[model samples]
Target: MSTFSRLGGLLLAAALPLGAQAELPAERIEPSIHAELAAHTRHFAQQIYRVAGNVHSAVGWQLGNVVMIEAPEGLIIVDTGESVSESRKIMAEFRKLSDKPVKAVVYTHFHPDHINGVQAFVSREQVERGEVHIYAHETLLQNVVAQGALVGPILGVRSAYSFGSFLPASDQEGMNAGIGPLAKAEPSSFIAPTVTFGERLDTRIAGLDVQFLHVPSEAPDEIILYLPDNRVLISAEVDQGPTLPNIHTLRGTRFRDPVQWVESLDKLRAYRAEHMVPLHGRPVSGQDKVEEVLRMTRDGIAYIHDQTVRWMNKGLTPDELVEKVKLPPHLAGYTPYLREYYGTVKHSVRQIYNGYLGWFQGDPVALDPTPPRQQAERLIALAGGREKLLLEAGNAYLKGDYQWAAELAGYAIRVDHDDKLAREIKARSFRKLGYASMNINWRNWYLMSAMELEGKLDGDAIRQRSVEMREVFLSPDMVRSFTPQSFLQNWVTRIDPQKAGDLELTLGFSFPDVDEQWALEVRRGVAQLHKGIPEGTELRLSMDKRFMETLLTGEGGLVKGALLGDVKVEGNLLEIRRFLACFDFADEAFGLTLR
Candidate 1:
């Protein structure tokens, strides 16, 4: 018996117990998880769902839905999709319901899918003039900035794999984005939030009574919106679509406290509301349906957390826990919401183990398993050299032992990274594993990694897409809160030790609009940033903070600003240019999957 069984014709395979769902027939007539994943595409067709008389949700428009709520004074938009182009189409459809101008935009959180498409609903000029107000949790700006400034490049690669962003847009290569139709890199814009709050904010928008609760869940700034007058509850990521909520995404995320997420679910349940609209899934009406979904979603998370802790107390390692923890038949076999579409018991158990105990498992040998490549080299030598290893991997693949084949191929690659045959064996093994995977994140990661291994994914194609992501992810609206201090601090890390080893110089920066002065002094091999331009500075550049911010993200308006005298340059031009060239730079040309 397998963990779950999907005979021919059934859509979901979670009808069986974990023990039963683990094994398929020795000869698989049809792959179960693959069929189920293909069937899951039905939920992602572009459609508009009317949750209530006044509230409608546009799912499949982008990674997340754009929900529109009609109010007495005007239309209040909640969650404005991911791309400007798609949101424009959604906004056009929303206009058919009512021609009311968008008065207020509520950002449930700072995910690109939630906040990136703000320009389609309201113009930056309108927001500046106070005609349209955007609302969000106060921490939204900081999180957004960190994603762009601190970790955007690495995240871009990881997200590309997890979202299958580079895969061909077809049923064979790419099907659905688990939660949505596809992952696209489109022109996106941002607007700074005008209204920010902590804990909770109770206010009236467009003549409708609304309350925003700041609960940390998927994102630290996640907030749920409640409409008292209409008895409607807008769940941001709390009710994360119709799948097992990704307590932790494979693309990498901060620790999503399962306890906090469960508590957030409880907070949503407290609102005994009649209607519910999720930013990811279809809206629900009737108190009973809402409660049922809420209860099941809550219990699914609680089950993973509690069960993992139960075994974790017995001194089990993460390796052991991934195999040990499984959803009880009730949660895994029956309900649609708890099915392993995006999140899985295997991944969540490891996260729980790490969350509670961190990287170490109280074993010194495990603590310093450093030099993993050397370790693989030694293991391969012990297994009779690279030739024998390749032979075993090929045999394993032929015998339908894909896991063993994949592991053996991994060792072969580590020993000889450029081995074409070794890479081919591993790529084939990964494709088979991907077909057997039910969680879309795991499936996509497998498929994309296989693509990278097979030389199918082009680096040139990836560079432009990653650059676009970096641009919007760290746009000016996100960096509005950054001060001269933040930008100066970044310069410390950007300094190049090899290039500036014997070169010494001082550069001063003045943001006239902000009335701030800063200086970076490079001494031999190190750089130091100070406030109020250091006395020995040889070069000083003055510009408005806005132009400076734009330059920081590489958006390119510096030439125009300099020619117009908006940016003033002082000191030796030749020396300044040489010194500036010493700093490190980043681009998407880095390896897509290989180290």
Candidate 2:
């Protein structure tokens, strides 16, 4: 059976029956803040003719529209949609625009929504036919590979929260209120580029003079392309309206450099183009409008940055900063472009602190902390009883004091796990929190956690679909940064002193389509991975790229999978097992506590 099947069966067996008791219907999500979707809708409708191509993203995500430029020599495709299915939709629309084949594809960045769907426009064979070129910033490839290694599992889990992927399409459950609709289309087979450049690359393609500017702040590998003749600037993913950047995505990843993100906006201001197209939202036309939007975006970031730094310098904690900071009236109103949809100012401020100070607030007390459960149990006893705590939390929830309600209810649940009333009250508090959040990630997390508590967990059947890892290609440097964190927990557990220097194994990983290979070495208790196979290696574990991923992720146990004949182990089997035994399983349950 497939890995998905085995995991699915196990989860399903453990799942609380859907009919155990109907969960209280999800409350209507209130739009606490304005969003950019409305403005984009109006703008796109007004400029439909200028739109060269468009694609429907999927059932649960916003639809992606593309504008293609056909020049005398070839074609320039902009803003590839989310995945293979979404890309096909774009191609179908491309047919409507013009029959010219795509000569080159320009990626805004490596975001799944923008770069995952390029294959629909042209085949790998056609690109190799020397008829097409894929263009992106120098860092784009690096970001793609780094993100690809973990995107599957992180997206697989957090996607459930962001897109309501497992929620049924019913009125009370899976309504597309959060991140609009999620793109449910199948992921495309990834295709890596045959060409790349540093700093800037000025090239002519499809009869258009394309000037690529490297912006490494928002995305280390992001590029903003300029069409000098058309006076159009493809802003890529950098300037997606005025909402705060998803600096620290809840779905999980390294912290984005917000300071550099501000710098990227300044770089974009130099373009002074008449038309600007973002990867996720509506395009801007006219120099004045583009400038206005860009200026506001810059100011928005500045406002957050300045205030955060001022407070940080004054020795304010993240919690104090969140409570004290507020946007000026000029920055407060809801503009479709400035709405907090994906990220919010409050969270962004916290991220800025984290990025600069590295989580230590210069407070020695914070260096070590008491465990949350132990503290919660003591607090519950001080509160008299779990029932009293639940009642108080429920009262607070009804009074719009969701933060306190959540805290108290959490303590009650921690104190008495079997207290169904406490769980119900806590879940209800989470529901309310979800209803009031403007950030889609926050809403999904709050709501999804509530759903799981109420015995309505969405199954993981969707992860079965195969995704071409190479399509979301990564650069060598990015791969190195990614491997350590992705497998840190597992690696830490598998180390054994007796076997420290007893094993030296080399494994080759190949992705034929992308023409990439990496040599992974296990020496002593440490793992050293490189671009090619190392010399005189005791073991040569050759395998498909995806299989290596499965092993790395701990989704497929190395020893068990090898024993089951799913993975090939060519060296000393005993050493391989010994090496595998060093890694420890991550306990996700720890996150549930307050600590």
Candidate 3:
């Protein structure tokens, strides 16, 4: 049997006890979770699903989905899938229907899944040569780079947990991300936007009239594409299939304003689209159905946001707010599209409370609390010592109270790091919790955490994987485009002060290909770049722009590049080596839930 077939059979067996309900509550995963997961695995087949004449959806195994429009001149591609590997398959599928070249590529947003697969649609050379035009929101170029430079490493690790990026793909294990199956990371590529516009851009591409509206929902750089003649709306992440929109992703990001999101939905609802195709999931057909879904989605978000604020005015704490907020029977009855497959109402309430009211709950105890570990130590003693806590935890586990058991075990282990018995109990509790989780991200994180506790996953491996993922999305041009002040801030913070110590050196860089010359000074672990050469320089490296990019990305060693004449180094070799040693390589295996 094929892998997918074998997995499907396993899912069938696992979900035998599950009833008609598609998902269980977040506290526990039951048999039905497997059925739902299996459904997600087969959600979008490798073939095209035509929504209208000349408009088709190609669903990739990866999270992102692409829409293709067959115009008279050629083809127009909207929102490429997650990775280069997935994009290649998506492109091949498009070719099966039409052999025309991609005339234009439109970005739905600056999210990695939406825009990372650009090279698959058209080569970078084609973009530079004016053969293919890439369009995106004007803020896309800036936001993409800024997000990467600021929180790239931290977010990458969280994403691994949220998307099951590090877990093995199998029915018994990671299964799939909530939206779609996981895609390979290595085959990812990024190309800068060729053309950018603000709120609206109406133009003709491939002999087809197109309208792009910057929606600013999931990402500030988001846009919704409308093909008027076809009456199809590519609604980006605004309406992601049969799942509730992730207004606040557990994988950290800036708060998505609920008010703005509702407004974006309002604008999209005005289109009266005959078919509404979202970037992440299956498309909606019929004008009335599209409007209905958009309305429910809008109202659902507003309900969560407005109610959370209402209760906040009543002096309710975040935890109390979570329990208090719930969709009305009418809206809650709307299944599939408005259900909590990806985002839940409880989390949304917490996000709303924090986003609007800040972290303080007006509780002085929470304002300045003891560190968890220190508190755990006291808690363990108050519970009659580690042995007493373990006894209680064991009883809780026996009673199937996995959440409480895990909490007790956590306290015991934190109080004594060498508590192997406590760790084992906690790991088992995590496994049970993972199995019971309805949220796919929660499931993945719980399962991964269990494995991590058992020493099955290495932090170093996670670190390496995250670094590679970051490298795939970031490019030298993206870095260069940042204002010098922004660029310097990112660069200087990367230096390891302990490594540099008292060493002070100036390095001059001459990029002959770009005709840009700059001087970099590293003193007391502080690094800064200036436009012209500094008065006192210890060493100089002259290289083509390409070589500089490679150096910054850590693709090639400085000594190797210098030896190969890729970088021409002058002055003291010792100073160059010392300068290179000052910057610390990122710690990829940084803890998530484990530590």
For each candidate, what TM-score against the reference?
Answer: 0.88, 0.78, 0.85
Candidate 1: give the clashing pairs: 1-20, 2-20, 2-21, 2-22, 2-23, 3-20, 3-21, 3-22, 4-21
For residue 586, model 1's alpha carbon misses the true position, in angstroms, by 3.1
**How do the residues 1-595 of candidate 1 rate in per-residue lDDT, one tens digit apiece?**
4413322111121122222113222323222347777777778788888866888899887889999889899989998888888899999988888899899999999888898888889998999999999999998877877777777787877777787776664524446767776755664578878999999999999888889998888899999899888789998889888789898888788889999999999999999889999888678789888888988888989999998999889998888988888888888864457888888888888888888889898789976685878988899889877767766776677677888988887876775666666676677778888878877898788878888877777678678657766755766666666777777777687788888999889889899888999988888878888888977677988888887777776664544776888778899888877778778865646544453
Best by lDDT: 1
Candidate 1 TM-score, true structure as reference: 0.88
Model 2 off-target regions past 4 Å? 1-65, 150-152, 171-181, 242-244, 416-418, 458-525, 529-573, 580-595
Each prediction's number of clashing residue pairs? 9, 19, 4
RMSD of 2: 8.7
Model 1 residue runs over 4 Å out of place are: 1-33, 171-174, 366-370, 475-483, 499-506, 521-539, 553-582
For each candidate in the order shown, give its overall lDDT on alpha carbons.
0.79, 0.60, 0.75
Better of 1 and 3 by lDDT: 1
Give the per-residue lDDT of model 3 (tens digit) for 39-137: 655664555779888988876556788888999999999987767777888888889899998888988888777877777788878988999988899
Residue-by-residue lDDT tens digits, candidate 2, 314-349 = 999899998877777676664755666666788888
Query: Which residue runs of candidate 3 sit more than 4 Å off their true CA positions?
Result: 1-42, 45-47, 147-149, 169-175, 475-489, 497-512, 517-543, 559-582, 586-588
